[model samples]
Target: MLGQGLVDVFFEDGLNWEADLLEDTRFVMVETTAYFEAYRHVLKGLQEIEEGQFPFEKYIIACENEVSPPKYLRNRRTVQFDLRPLVDENIVIREDEALRRQRRIVNYQFSAESRCAESVEILNLRSWPRPDQLHLDQSQYEALQTALTKEFVVTQGPPGTGKTYVGLKIVKALLHNASIWNSGHQSPMLIVCYTNHALDQFLEGIDSFFKGNIIRVGGRAGEDMAKHSLKVKKQALRKLQDMRQIAGVRFNCTKSMMEVKLEIERSGAQMEASEREILHEDMLRPFMDNCYDQMTCVELPQQQEIPSMMVEWLGLEQMLGETQVAVQQGREDDNLHDKQEDEIALSKRICNASVRLSTVTTKFVNPTIVLTTMPVHESSLLTSSNTTSVECHGQQ
Candidate 1:
């Protein structure tokens, strides 16, 4: 009777499978013998699933089975399937673990013998140093002290509470202690932020004090100021810089002064006055002589005589002739100015441009503090040393 029942269930499952297969538009009906032959051809149609394309349902199924499904099935449309059993099993396990953790936390909280409990009793919170430099409030000072002494501390407050400020002080104190403990060796510190904007703000706040000791990873906006960022590693940045230099040089050599002046004027509103001045002084003036030294340098096709009516309406006849005369006159005195000042300014810009790329490439050579959006605890920079990691998050 049991064997007959098992056979009935097997047939029922097969019929359900057949119905599902038929419902799916991707599958077609075939004779049982022909199906085996078609399978070989169908397998050839399978393509590898790209990363991040896996559906939520398929992910859950994969997790439940504890095995990866075939690549072809990964992209298939999800069917209505009951996941209650797997979900229930996970919920039960998690609930039990939560209960266990709750009991542990309760014991730790109430037990007089616990180290944290003992610290609260013996430590004089009032005696904690209030550094004049940090200008911490009473609440922030208490929070800082607790964080420094305890293994785990939760500091919570509403917005604009100086949480980040106090946390940075705590980090500074810990770094000083670590350096002493490690016999004058600078200790590595990893600072994690919730967002790239926060990371930039934090780095900017401490940049003067830390100077070359800080390295920032991720985000393109902070690249130039932070000295280190992941954007520096991209080949595109290097290429763009090279192209800019080439274009600057080419614009000086190829284009006439009148044409260049018109181009600059058209885009002048978008550029800073200082930047416009630099372009005129460093790039345009130096190359102006080369541009107009030879009349043959004009690359444009010869224009026919302009109509009197159009020239009067446009007022281009005088402007165009005057621009040519100015260029010729300016070429005479081009060699009279000092080239040293321009060279110095150009060198400074080049140095500033390469700083981020150089810093990111050589960051691991020394013990340094890193500011990043996520914790890079597994990085060799942290793992190789006795590093202290501090995570700070807030609305500010």
Candidate 2:
């Protein structure tokens, strides 16, 4: 009643509202949007019901008693009652109008015509391949066979009879025979359960063996499946994109720096051969020795240094030394960046993030298997898909 939007006279914490009896007051029941979302699936399921096909008749109940009954009055007394037409047409038309509006937009995701012919045509279970790994009893095998050969199946048993075990086997069988059911495209499989615990157990089992795209829609999943939730996947995808972009920008900067370095080297090489020789032989010796050993050094050993040309050359060499250090640092940074990039790529591949989604169309864009509860199944966020083929495996 809380999440489904029903009128309640008490607070959520089991407390009743108190009003001043001496003052004028009014009680109001405000409508919320929860009912609309909760009942949207009903609208979709009832799409085939046409006008005048509503199963229930509209009637108004009236109490004809003029005197008030005692607080202790029980079933011992009978009161006069009358059933009449709902003359206030708004009462009846409101629900009808809401349903009409919902019906206009409710597009059915599943249809009977899309079912596989082989699913209904197959009569013998011996025609299907049986894996050596599956160890199922007669009942479990029969249930799995029914699931593989039929469009819909319900496997019911007590707690310890391996209902979920058979469901997992059916999923495995479907994976093995996806081409027959999905027309060569390994489209998504939707598994709807009645509880979060059941959804978690089913998802963990699927994650253990099935290595394709899978996502848990609800937040109450166990820790093992938390990282695979749609919200977490989107966040991880965004972080991956951001890191890649930053790495790209840094790479461009490193490339520009290397280009500038190459230009400097080219300029140094363009000097006349004799001039280069002089700078190498004459200038370098005096500068390294810090003495007037060469004619380029104008003054005494301790007083003045090399010539202005030599001095300028030494300054350029110092600048080049600093640039080399920067280049080395950039290279080191790039190495670290590459390592981080590799780690991210590995994690993405493991999480199926590589094929997961780069944009809105990317998530669930591949052959996906979604495990969720009944409440989440009704949620538009989980059931929304444009994929043409959907294979469902049910267990109860």
Candidate 3:
């Protein structure tokens, strides 16, 4: 179970507890905020312990960051913590009832995230090819470590059947169709293939983009990353205004500044207890103005609910768009053999990567077990008793 609470106290340092790990410890992942508090509390508590006061149990903390998924290499259920909650309320715990009473500050990120602990999604592809949705007979991804997911299935097909070329198309289909995490801005899907040859081919199919198309996302994934790359970005700002209903700090900004505003507002990061100076009304006003002028219309989507994963799809489109257009033009400009030439090197690379993922989908799709038989005489198989089960192939 995910342990959450305002840190009434904390413990850290290499764990000194002596217990059978598999039986006693449960796997734990804590947020970054929780991490800081746990460390600080433990450090302080340990110092206090050395001074002959705080309890001894709080000293041995072998805490790891939230990203480190605990492994049971030797059957130890580990605990990880994120102390993001303690950013501003550390020393001031006396005022807050949850902190005073030592209640776990179980926020939405913790609660929502706890439900997805075991079945996290991971990607395994390495490249892309043209016409990404090209269908194979299926079974190409049977060997990839991360490709085998109970939540999803992998398919394999031969070169003409579209195994490599179909990566981006599949991603787009999933983004538009199956995704439950359909945030308007979140479009980060990847189309990895085993070979650069396949990569080039995949690129050839997707880039036939006409000008002035918003949905033809190919290369703009980085824009979203740039827009939101922050130590903190806020979501659910309305909730904070409710939290601050009593102590109203006057603030306003144009619609343009709303992105940055939403980020900070969404974070709800309390800083009152920190050494840093808090933002006064006047000081924060100009920041909004600057952000307003800097904000672009393209950055503001009509859909706020879009997932960032969508951005990757868009980027993939733009990248593939450019590539597909080039391929079409190349076929027009050069000899027909150019397509084969482009594929030869990549086909070889796929051969090597096939230890984990195959290049030719046919190898995967066809059954490995063979039924052996000798060639029989055509006359014996097609005797007059067959009564001419005639099939017509009429031609002019």
Candidate 4:
């Protein structure tokens, strides 16, 4: 059994005690009954303390048994007991409340009502030309309509049943009426595939109809027409550059004014108050204004412009420059193989950098649609309040 004083000390410093013991020791052991008794004693002590009737001093006496007294009560004023080792061994194992709550929430979120709402009838589609003209059979058209009206709907079919074709049509119809479903800005949607090849094919279909902003995260940007490709490292570097530019303008302006002030203070000359004020107003204000104007006048490139900017920024243009030089040199050299090899190497480097830059700069473009393989769908980049994802899979 645990003394009340020891229980009080445990309540006050249990976390620190556990951490220190765990650092030096792999595990601690205790008797089953004594361990439970200690927990009960601590809880009782806490309740008594809360009720304003705690008997702290009454339980401070050292026991005659081998179990030492608690560390806090070991001073000369009262009974001294070395109870640290005894109590440290008797830690109670309990379920983590927070983790339990999280699991419950996840279970609820994946339930039938949350994953797929009840199917509802949609209005006639004769007024909508593209959806009406889609080559879906009656069942495929009904599935398409159900997806549009329901908050969450899953489409399943065997191979070669026009599943993808009908899904694309539904996406197109949703994109056309996006304003009705969401706020009048962009409609954020995610398309997830089981493989990179499937992701590319899905993006191609989206590109054919949906002309809004699209960002592709993960894997290479295989198609030249892909809107945005995000390469991790180069994108991180670009973000760092953007941060520096934002801070450099204000920092340089402040530093310039400070230098002028220091110069004036160092010049061993007495000046009237009005003259010093005039010097500051004349020297500092215009320079600062000019700096601000210069910074603001520069317009940052739009998302569509990032590919071109990356070509220049990543030195792809320099590789092209070498290619031009190689072409001119080829005219003078009879060894055509050397010219061909040089051109191939340079072209490969340029192409690789182009794909990387396209991948890295994708997030900045605020794409309305994102297509990624299922393995990478859980990436933090894809989770946004405004976005919704659709997962497509096929039997292996």
How well is each residue in 183-270 modelled by candidate 1, as lDDT tens digits? 3234456777767788887766555333234556655547445445645445557989999999998888777786888888866743
Instruction: For each candidate, give its TM-score against the true structure.
Output: 0.27, 0.39, 0.17, 0.30
Please tell me which predicted candidate would have the highest lDDT against the true structure.
Answer: 2
Kindly list the per-residue Cα lDDT of model 3 for residues 299-380, writing each as its tens digit.
6445443232233334553564576689998877786577777799789887655432112111222446333233332313
Q: Tell me how far the alpha carbon of residue 237 in candidate 3 is from the true structure, in angstroms, after superposition.
A: 28
Distance from true location, Cα of 332 in model 1, Å: 88
Model 2 Cα lDDT, one tens digit per residue, 1-396: 878965445443455545433435556765675667655667676886775564431221232223222222223332221100011111111112354345432122323322222232234445433322235577776786666544435589989998987887666545534434553343577887767788998988877655566778766888988977899989989999999999999999999999999988865774655464444444345346645445344454464333344544455645655766899999999999999999998997776632321111223445874433332232133224553323333332
- For all candidates in order, the CA lDDT equals 0.47, 0.54, 0.36, 0.50
Q: What is every candidate's alpha-carbon RMSD to the true fold?
A: 38.3, 39.8, 42.3, 42.3
TM-score of 1: 0.27
lDDT of 4 at 365: 28
Ranking by lDDT: 2, 4, 1, 3
Better of 2 and 3 by TM-score: 2
* Tens-place lDDT digits, model 4, residues 257-298: 999998788553435544542233233334566654544354
Candidate 3 stretches with Cα past 4 Å from truth are 1-152, 157-159, 165-168, 209-396
How big is the positional error of residue 12 in model 2, measured in Å on the Cα after superposition?
25
The better-scoring model by lDDT among 1 and 4 is 4
Better of 2 and 4 by TM-score: 2
